[model samples]
Target: MDGTSQSQPQPPEQTPTSLSPSAQLDLAITLALHNWPVLSLAVQSSWGGPTSADKRDWLCAAIAELFTDRPDTDAGDLEEVLLQVMNDEFDVVVDDESAGDVADRIIDLKGKIDKGDLEMVNKLWEDWKQREGKASSVGLFKRVETNDEDQETDEDEEEDGEDEDVEMEDAPATRPPREVIEPEVDEDGFTKVVGRRKR
Candidate 1:
């Protein structure tokens, strides 16, 4: 056998978690720049063209995770860089979906960051993260609108009850046990039916 030195396979790269925050950001941005162009391609082995959802999801997840380390880093500016890379380099227009929303927020954040108004950004991030955390804890598909609508309806009922109480003072307190009276507002901005009883 001839003694020929074989080339050794390179080791896998280190993850950003092992690096400093700034370095982590730099690494993420570098990787994003490199990988973004292929983001739309190979989603489903498109003989026609790359899919938008795959690319959008990839970029959004990358940017979101990239900024997870928030201290002493201009996350907004970094996000702006991501947007610029996608738009300027990739020439992709992202106007709708979570990625677009994230991009819009990043644009807003860039302005605040430039003005040194970090408190607003932090507050917004906190609120957004809180909502995202709660959404994650529950099944994301679960409808939270039910709870919100119920709460709003409860408030409306309470307000209506107050008005009813004022009107009921002159009337008898006891009514038919199965019958209920309520106010119904019409499209004309008027309560057309007041104290209408169910048959």
Candidate 2:
């Protein structure tokens, strides 16, 4: 053997379980780097992160927390999807037959709008709009009409104000001359508290 060449040192072995939380997170992000903006950070200005995985994990959790039906939404599901995307080399892969399955889960109205036959494409403005009605926010924050109790309370407060406005502006003064109750006496000669009275 010639023994002319020297070998270079290699990166330390990185088994999946041996990965720290941060390293696992790094692997997750590296896996998804080519896709759309990591939405977790852009979703809210208040969001900041130690790594991409935190944002990704939070993003999936937030989506599930906000809208549970879209995907299974468990972190494990997100992990599986993300890793699947990575294994597929970041090509867009839609598990459901159509985009509507995804739209239905996350965008409540969009799912409702999807065609039943799967052959028909839905029109965004015509069919979907009438179904949504006057709900500008599309049921995210519904405009609930005042309930009976709230209506009654509001009416009482308004009437109370109107009555006060029509009557004497100042409340009548009362005498503050009343005395409190006498203290209790004990056999040991120490005064004990019986009860309190208002002056």
Candidate 3:
């Protein structure tokens, strides 16, 4: 060690205290969206057109704006917005009831933020940063299909106690199989490959 060497001061630990209430709310919304498995799958699979990623960013801003514009917004209102967005933007009808849970979490976070408590927001931010860009292990949901014919058949089977030995099978897939489109060449001779659902 040199005699004239001096120790450098370490930076202070980062905290959410420096963020404004609106910004904190925005962060909470973003993190909430990130943790949503349905939205994650839609974005990963590009269900919302070619700009699915951009749509997610737009959703975060829109949600934050909703809270700002209407302070009385509750979990129900949030859930409606989430459901509409999924349907309109990603062509996804969310029947798993996870939207309500996500809305509740966001509403709870906003309430805490209103009271100047940022602990939850900070923890979520830290967790998101730690796992950014990583594939989520959360299991995806499957859509249930039902019809009058199937229901009548099920009832007839149940009446005779003939359904007892039926083994449960895997749920039907939620999405159609994607087929890669033929590569197209641009004026600059660049090739673009696109994936679309097989009809």
Candidate 4:
């Protein structure tokens, strides 16, 4: 046996004032929102903007990336942090069910984004916003079609109101189907369709 025993090295002491996961997440979200233009855009896109769901998806991905390099991080812990920070930062109330879905999407998008070119993420967001803006406005420019035959039938019924027994010979013969009416463009650049005429 050796006369002198070897001593093990001491581990570094951890500070007692370290931030909790929620606090850390809060700080991260705050910084990103303020300093990162893309994150701010992502947050804005979440509010009924184009590719809203996709933006949310990317946001979760970015959040996942934030903690991926940290030690002792778990999916559930990350999700809890995400839900708390998102609720606080976005000023929106989300139910537990939706939080779970958001967490799942975050994990999935993180994996996909990891495998692809990160630069494309911003481009994708911009393109989606433009495309969705135009597509969503389609309803404003498009016109709804009405069946002319139905309208004509309605008119005839009104003309024969109380004379259900009117002589068939005296009554005008059934007319051919009315011409298909096209929508007229107004001066305001909107399509104007004639509404059903009242009796």
Candidate 5:
């Protein structure tokens, strides 16, 4: 009880700045958007980051703040770029993170989502889908199935490939001259190394 500050509430548990490296990049990139100057001022002025963990949470909160203010203009590219950067840097050799923890966190974001306060995070999801291709897309804590539209598109591609194969088989053979009468070996003991070169 003595450790507790009487006037101030205890801060949340210290998570990594941005929770993960990718999240860090996403937050920074998202802040650079148009409303960034205004948003940055707000975050810097209000958010007290005595610890590194607090700094990240603050950054994310700032971006969410901007998104809330300017939803239409927010394309979510910042999140995608950061995620791409993260993937290139880190290998996904393990999937050992806890699902329950993930779900809990996603639930926590729901209130923000309701407030139109989740932009880059949502954009990150779209980018994830496009990058994963046939495997489909996923959200933060959300596992999305890559829809049948892509599958149907793939099937169309296979059909086109089949048509191409048929066209190739049906086309007449333009190649000719499998054999030729060597022009008397150019009067030497060795065959001529030049002249058309058996092309």
Candidate 6:
């Protein structure tokens, strides 16, 4: 018997051209979220419970829904959504203001998608793939050990210590419940309501 190698059929690669506008927006949102250090830290640390990964996916859907409901959705609205979700779902208060940047990137990508420009989406997808490949090869979320002396600074030690010592505590037993605002569609068929939770 002659030894001959046969190549196996490969699965179809998902390119930017293959995705619909909605799917492109969803992928853009996911890439933006993953690139955010705060959200990445939260997921890596399991801040949103054991299903933190699922929560991130849910966030992508929620953000996509906002765009579907209102094409004119801006960064301010998206920032509020990011902040609210971080506070409620992950019990994390993102005071660093990085959420605004993430929101802006998402909105920009959305606008590009609306205009049928998928270049940025394709770039982000490539970046994500490269990052994921590296993360898989070498553990991306490995915890680092630092000595107490190394943490000490010349500035206000107390303030620095306080900030660094902050840990993720369990959510309050009696916290205000989130109120879901119903969408109010106008004559133009655009939703006047932005999904926001009352603090």
**Highest-TM-score candidate:** 6
CA RMSD (A), model 3: 21.0
Q: State the lDDT of candidate 2 residue by residue for 1-199, as single tens digits.
A: 7988878886453232333332222222222221233332222332222333444443433332323234334434544554443223222344433323332332332133222221111222223335544353132111111122333454587676655353222222223544767787889988986663221
Q: Candidate 5, residues 81-186: lDDT per residue as tens digits?
A: 2233223222112123322233234333444444545554555444544555423321322211121233245458767765434323322223343466565575
Model 4: colliding residue pairs: none
TM-score of each: 0.24, 0.19, 0.61, 0.28, 0.19, 0.64
Q: Return the top candidate by lDDT.
A: 3
Worst 10 residues of 4 by lDDT: 139-148
lDDT comparing candidate 5 with the true structure: 0.35
**Candidate lDDT values, in order:** 0.41, 0.34, 0.71, 0.42, 0.35, 0.71
| Model 6 alpha-carbon drift over 4 Å, by segment | 1-7, 134-199
3 or 5, which is superior by TM-score? 3
Candidate 6 per-residue C-alpha lDDT over 1-199 given as tens digits, one digit per residue, 9 for 90 to 100:
5798888986555565665566667677877898999999989988877778777867776687677668788999999999998998888999988999999899899889989999998898777667687444122111001111222331255565665333213222334675666778999899886744432
lDDT of model number 6: 0.71
Q: Model 2, residue 50: displacement in angstroms?
A: 24
Query: What clash pairs does model 2 have?
Result: 70-105, 104-111
Q: Tens digits of per-residue lDDT for model 4 on 20-131?
A: 3332232223223233333344466554245443334444334534564463555576667656655544434455455555445444434444454333333333343365
lDDT of 3: 0.71
The per-candidate count of clashes, in order, stands at: 0, 2, 0, 0, 1, 0
Which lDDT value does model 6 have at 108? 91
Please list all clashing residue pairs in model 3, or write none if there are none.
none
